[model samples]
Target: MNTSIPLAASDAAATSPTTLIYWFRNDLRLDDNPGLLKACQKANNLLLVYCHDVAAWQMTRWEVPRTSRHRQQFLASTLADLAMQLKSHDSRLLEVEGPPAELLPALARAIGATTIYCEEIAAPEEQEEVAALRAAGLTVETVWQSSLLDPTDLPFALDDLPDVFTSFRTTVERHHVLPPPPLARPQKIPALPPAYAALVEKWGATKGAISSGFADAEPIEHQASNSVTYRTGGRSSFPYFLPLFSGGASAASEHLHQYFDRKLAHTYKLTRNGITGVDYSTKFSPWLASGAMSARQSYAVLKEFEAAHGANDSTYWIWFELLWRDYFRLLHLKYGPQLYRAQGLTSLPQPSHDARAFDAWCQARTGESFVDAGMAELSITGYVSNRLRQVVASYLIHDMGCDWRAGAAWFEAQLIDYDVYSNQGNWLYIAGRGTDPRNGRRFNIQKQAHDYDPDGAYRRLWSAQ
Candidate 1:
């Protein structure tokens, strides 16, 4: 029952001229990706492939769409940027629409691929994809490159990981664990074989060969609207800080540099809780979640800034948050599918589900102004502050008493930067079903508003229109 997949021996032992398929999953960027580097090293000819999950466009059990237009558009932009980068390096991204389990094996066979290289995602659905590919006799090479700290450097084994964040952080810090410096971007990626490229184009062109419905789907633009829209630059509303916030590796790196250049990390702890505007927090989560930004890359830059600017609590806290990210990733290794259960990592009876209450929470008709404002922002822009997220999540589970998974699923559907590990872990934690020491976390909505939005500015800003 061991689900932690290792790179196939055949793939690892691969030498000499060979055709390889580099399947892009969560790790979308070219920089600091060990899997992509491995692919380049092994590939005489590479075929870059991205399969859009057709299931992502459909509704979940909660009745809301699994992925919103904003997230889908962001992904499209990311793919387009990746495609441009590949072309510049004598390669191209094959964008198709279908389950990776089905599309990948067929595509690999069609192109004479012997191996596939991809990021190792521990979640059930992602894991299943790799298993299926291997079952099809393709050697799949999976890399663990998502966390700031590598699993090998952890103070304990995955099964022995600390149950709480504080203990895990303290132990790692005590052991002086540091993430390796970010890898430099590859100068040039291996080119796809001309014949393979032609085959990819041909398969993509075929209607029934791939997920035909969204194969040629286009990236959507941010339109200005009163309800849900991407236009965020204006008074009386929290501006989205658009044009600069496009999804891609370049954009992620640029924003990281700009944040440090402007000396914004110094005040991150102070303003991270603010509900409105772009400057309130680092806003790196979206890129980081989407794999446009590497946790190690961001950590390396943070250390460089601290070396020049001197260390402070804020700088240290940024790294602390990253440690939390790593902690959840490790927790996945420990608990596996238990993290997704109704009573996650616990033996408590399942939490009750209420459809009507859940609908009200999702619709932002929860009668709590702060919760409504946060939900509205998430609905409209596909973004919300960390503080707002906790507030809304607490309100949903504690005040509304809806199933935590329902709320987690809603966030999954709407968030532009959704990461499965963090999304599920956080939801389970708040619901008292995961690794929370106190069992469950409850927030006082009135007090949260009074503290974070004293003048009711955030509530007024989002509630209007």
Candidate 2:
């Protein structure tokens, strides 16, 4: 059995001996990926690898798994798709479960790879990994692929990012750093050796064996699952808002096309605050959060729609939401450790801890029926509306007085579309320690429930009322 499948070209000088390793981190798709393209152009042979970091998965401080089965299933589906795509280019994704710090360098040595390419991550732990790779003398190149506007094109230095969302938005709007056009997908990918194919197949067959590599760190018990539900987050998962939509890069693109082509951009503002139904909101956040869809792609589609259909406040609000996402990312980069602290970005003293109260909140036993309903929904569905997210997050931090980090970490463990920057950013904001100019703006739970769920339909659905 020839495991080394020839994809694009087989006759390209096999004896050149230099290989390039493309490390697939969060950016899984081949479309609009600059790092993958650059790596392919530079090397005679390409070895694509997805390292399932056991250390990262196992080191959860909470009882919940850091990467939920919902996320795992989505990633597995994504990798399966990526493998098929790579085969079209004469490449394959070599899946391995281990610390990349050890696995990557060893694989590079084994393949005689001269360069390793991956998407750049700004989070503290991911940066540490990059530093460790450099310390090992491997030539690692990282490209910024997640953000809509490249970091280099930002209006100011990263350290100079504004402390307020409004200020950051104003600066960007004034200077207007447009996102670059999406990168074209390549027609072909370089090939690997027959020995590499055999190694990958053997590795895939015994992936569970390497589960030990990530065993030291306890897995957090996430409530989300891969079973088809309205809240699932896989390629085949139920469509939330925009039931016509699917869950992946291709689906997102199609949604954008119809929204723009049909001039539906004009009604975005009117329907955005809607609590139910698929078309009420853009429904881009889940994929955007996971790096399956880029903000720039959304922007481009919206612009095309506006050109054909004419721009309006509704059309602009989509950009406004993207700006909010960007604002959160910049906030994390600026505050760094402050965002992780107990008091958050605020100078206020940290809230007192109450273990029993915290447990009640987590378990949906809180006496506040509305709050409990939101909690139950999240526990069962792995999702809560943005309005409810604010309500529950505030109740957890202010009313219950739990550690904000604990709540954030729990969100990290459960959310299928959790982004480190957004998860931490929103948690800090709710804790009254973030960039929100109004400090400690805790939501009134009863008032919110009455307002958003007047008939108590939502509460009834979750069995919390």
Candidate 3:
């Protein structure tokens, strides 16, 4: 989340102050926020709110937890960090437990604010939330801030986005496309209105503050990771139990600097595919997934590192991986609700979902060693390696003959870094759907295990349970 570029104050700063509501969605940090920054510039007294969607905590169609306890624990850290930042600026974030459309309108009326501003999410359910908000007769403004490259800067229209990733990459590279510089955090924030207290009392809206005692605090050493029914064995690749790998902008920025200072980018391509430990990968996804880190901030720092040292193929590979992330997001903008369909933009018939087989896969009761081991690690740690993700996903769809959507739902439930776009896009690609012109992937599990887990280290690491 570190940015090297100099930041300028907004030209459209502080227009006729009005009471407004700024809803915090995926983009949590204030450091590089376009939506929150705009809210600050226009508001005299702003009500900051975040809603814990009931649906997020409920069961999915696949009969798995939509979001796991561990995922919520990590989110609690991020929310705590956000609250501390707001507190520094003499503001408070109201944590409500309900859907946005239901809670926000009442909260907006309570605060006497007619408009709600937030980040735009391109997924189906999120879009429905926004549409529902508009139907309630409120002005809701959404900013597109998640992507590194601005969609307006693209050489081609979204409707014409290349079907293949290679074509998309070459087109952008050919145009020498670059993301806009990261913005500075707002130095001065508007004060809360006198009505805020009455509003909170009248509506009884702010139920509880999860950020109460954990803001920027050190996590206990050797403490058990708070997960579902079971605790990790302390061999997690992405260890959320420790403070270093904990969720927040501070940790994310520190981790980013540590990765670059140690010059890991120079050998990233070589180590990226390794399926063990935190050192094998950049491990930036969790922060990025939660919006504690911005892709542009990471890119800006990468450019600085390249300037300080010399550029190489390894450094370029980092950018390559980032583009892959962007491509999946753009796919959402292009296909929208179709991406959520079972066939996923293909002429193929609906996928056959073996519920019993899927249950075994989810419980790690599947006899396949590599796949089960990977599933076990995910269940325990709320994370798994990118290589193993591909291997296990393929094993479920191609080998076990289970539905790809079922695997995606399980990932949605477990992954602390569960990204909707990437999860759906990758699942579609593996299932011979989505935008893959060559039609889906079918990774050979035996070959993958032999190639990556040559000495059976990864499998043995999670073999016992």
Candidate 4:
């Protein structure tokens, strides 16, 4: 539950003073970001900041770090590029090290910022951070910007959203509800206060500076040209990951252009279930997960593609997938913390957790060839194809009889494209604890391997690894 009270836009405009802080969370890009534009419009002296929380690196109860080295490297690349983008607009992302509730309030007080603007995240941990900021007496304004369709535009309230995806999709389509076009990136951003850099200097002098691996104690300079080089900094077992898809708005935009420019979307439905190679899918999840690309931005581009190439099942299916992502987000809002519980939305008996079985599955020694291949692929690379994700998750819950939460946690830790709402929702769905009309998703592993990888090439390739 989010405890922060909503602040009206007019109130924000009326009461805003000189200094403003725009805290970037999941929405890392400049374009199509309403909160960022509001920050730019409201601030006379703007300070842009992003906090890298230490909690993200800590180990979970499942004995895995909450985030992976590959994901961190991708994030580092994204932030480096985002910092450069901000620099292009006379601002820089003051890459701070600490909890946002701690660092943001201190920085806001130091710079005398009256308002803090950010994207609203509905997840439990993220919600607590926002609540903490409000409790600290910051005038925090948040926009519900993650979904393709705005909550206000929905035909029904979020609490009334249908449990099943099909019903939700039908209602939304019947209402003719659509997402508005994305906002453009600002041409120029407000300059940081000259005295603002002195806070870090003061902190360094007092030995109170937070040790963010990405932050430097030097004054954050806002330059005309971006000087930072984009590199996936940390070591990763998934060498095949980042090169295939880099982070930040630049890469996302370029990929969108090339994907539609080549008319690849026409065959999306045909190859979306494929288990190997890049051309099998659009591969936009990584960018979408990090907020480097907005859903509305993707939808707008998708509409343009439809206009130029004519609407087809493939294009419609692309929209369907986006809607599914939106449905998970809405479901999170409707269910709140129930979405994270072991029982989920159902009254099903809690599944027993076996740490030893989970360990074997995680290490790819399950001896189930297809499951092993999928797990091995995920273990070696921080990514798995959608078909493989379903297969692996089903095997974990149904075949191995392990708890779904452990599998969900592993996915959270490992995937470069982990979105909390979607990951947890999908896990619960597979475990029969969530929005499933039938008995939930249980794939026949051997049959799946035969149908998708008859040649056994994918199994052979990943099993060797």
Best by TM-score: 3
TM-score of 2: 0.86
RMSD of each: 6.5, 6.5, 7.5, 8.0
Give the range of the ten consecutive residues with the poorest summed lDDT in model 1.
210-219
Stronger candidate by TM-score (1 vs 4): 1
Give all TM-scores, in the order shown: 0.91, 0.86, 0.92, 0.89
- Per-residue accuracy of model 1 over 1-465 as CA lDDT, tens digit each: 999777688865564468889989988899998899988877888888888778776767877667776676677667767878777887788877778888888887776887899999999888888999899898999999899998998878888898988999999999999999888767668877667756666655332432233221112234334332433325312223344677888788888999999999998888777777778777788788878899998988898899999888898889988988888888888888889878788898878778999987777788888999888777767778888899999998887878899999989887888999999989988899988999988998899999999998888877843
The CA lDDT at 144 in model 1 is: 91
92-141: candidate 3 lDDT, tens digit per residue: 88777778999999888776788989999999999999999999999999
Better of 1 and 3 by TM-score: 3
The per-residue C-alpha lDDT of model 3 at residue 378 equals 86
Clashing pairs in 4: none
Off by over 4 Å in 2: 1-17, 56-59, 205-247, 258-264, 335-338, 346-351
- State which candidate has the highest lDDT: 3
- lDDT against the true structure, each candidate: 0.80, 0.71, 0.85, 0.81
Ranking according to TM-score, highest score first: 3, 1, 4, 2
Ranking, lDDT, top scorer first: 3, 4, 1, 2
Evaluation by TM-score, superior candidate among 1 and 2: 1
Worst 10 residues of 2 by lDDT: 214-223
Q: Pairing residues by index, what is the TM-score of model 4?
A: 0.89
